[model samples]
Target chain A: MVERTVRIGSTHGLHARPAKLFTQAAAASGAAVTIQKAGGAPVNAASILAVIAQGIDHGDDVTIVVDGGDESAVLDQLVELLSTDHDE
Target chain B: MMEIKGTGIGQGVAVGPVVRMAEALPEPVDRPSHLDPEREGERARASLSVVAAELANRGAKAGGAAKDVLEAQAMMAEDPSLIDEVTKLLATGKTAERAVYESFAAYRDLLAGMGGYMGERAADLDDISQRVIAHLLKLPAPGVPNPGHPFVLVARDLAPADTATLDLDQVLGLVTVDGGPTSHTAILAREKSIVAIVGATDAASLADGDTVVVACR
Candidate 1:
């Protein structure tokens, strides 16, 4: 699995809209992906429900893991998604 | 009507009828499930999925910026961690309604305890919990009131879902008894250029049809 820790860029954090966008992207990637807040348990990144339950906020460090299926490319796309300010 | 002080949103002012959003459903009573744990679990799962799907549908209909907010809410309805929590509660013989309520409350308390931006999320959790419980009980989801006329909306606060579907043409202004400048109610008001005052604790006593001035300076 490939993993990267990135800071959340959405000013309002990873609440509803950003969480939905991130989860939809993860699910579409067709990769086994998981996300974890700092020192928190890892959750299915593609499950919007799991992502929002984490209550991740702006500037929070989250680790994204992609286990297979073109890991580098998928991770890069997810990283870009996480680091963009979707709330703007 | 008596004047109430709060942080105003935008620079506009409006006056009209007062229509209050329904108060949140009362907390679910803590009681053992009359049905077996498995049945209770099934019931809980069904309601969760139903609420989630409804939210997703609303998102699709809303489109644009509101679509994202509604979609996020739909996710909260079916979140994996939340399901785990509800299942655990069900295993303890709790009814599906109580299980969903308590499970969401656990997360709501967690966010509220965090304070600042996270604290504001407690309202979101409350909104979700209400949706799930309302589904389980076969009740209409509690939200914005349609009094069949343009009115000044009064509520404790406006959830994202409520604000997304609000009839801007019918709403002359908004007044909340509890909410800050950053609350969802405030954001929607500013975004739509509607007059609003939030965090006016005194507004709690305002009733339906009350006439009040929303002085935005």
Candidate 2:
């Protein structure tokens, strides 16, 4: 498994629209991925409900774990997604 | 006629009879399932998919901002964490209705407990739960009313699902008893330029078929 940490970049944090965009990308990635907020339990990154429930905000650091597929490539792509401000 | 007050959205005046959103469904009973867990799980998944598809369909038709909101709601219907909860409940011999109800309720309370923005999201979860339960029971999906004519819409609060597909031609104004200025109801009203009064606690007394003028400056 490969893990990467990135700070959330959306101005309003990972609320509805941004969360939806991120989860859609994650679910489409075809990798076994989970996201964890700093000091919080990990949850399926593709599950919009779990991700929203985490209430991850802008500047909050989150770790993404990828256990399958092209680990490095998928990790890098997800990290890119998480780092961009979707609200913009 | 009595005048009630709330934070208004947009500047408009409308007079019409009231058409209240359907009341929330009763909590599903916790009776043991008569079927095997596998069958119950199949039934639950089917209803979840149906509701998800319906929400997405509404999103597609509404377009614009409502598209994203409703699409996210569609994702919520099949969320893996919630499905896991339902699986556990079914393993305990709970009926699919009760299992789905309790599973979503658990998550709903969790989100609501977080308060603030998260608290507001609890309603979205409740809306999903109600849709799935209604599907399981083969009952009409609970949401905005289609009274077959022009009227004012009054409700405790408008869920995004309800607000997204509102018939602009039929709904003259909106009155919500429990939402704030930042609620989805208000936001959509502003976007759509609908006359609205939110947090009008007194509006609850306004029964169906009651005619009233909603004037917002």
Top lDDT prediction, candidate number: 2
**What docking grade applies to model 1?**
medium
What are the lDDT scores of the predictions, listed in order? 0.85, 0.92
TM-score (0 to 1) of chain B for each candidate = 0.92, 0.96
**Position A14, candidate 2: lDDT:** 87
Looking at model 2, residue B115 earns an lDDT score of: 89
Give me the displacement of residue B90 in model 2, in angstroms: 0.6
Best by TM-score: 2
Clashing pairs in 2: none
Per-residue C-alpha lDDT of model 2 across residues B84-106, encoded as one tens digit per residue: 99999999999999999998888
Give per-model TM-scores: 0.84, 0.95
Q: Positional deviation of A60 in candidate 1, in angstroms?
A: 7.3
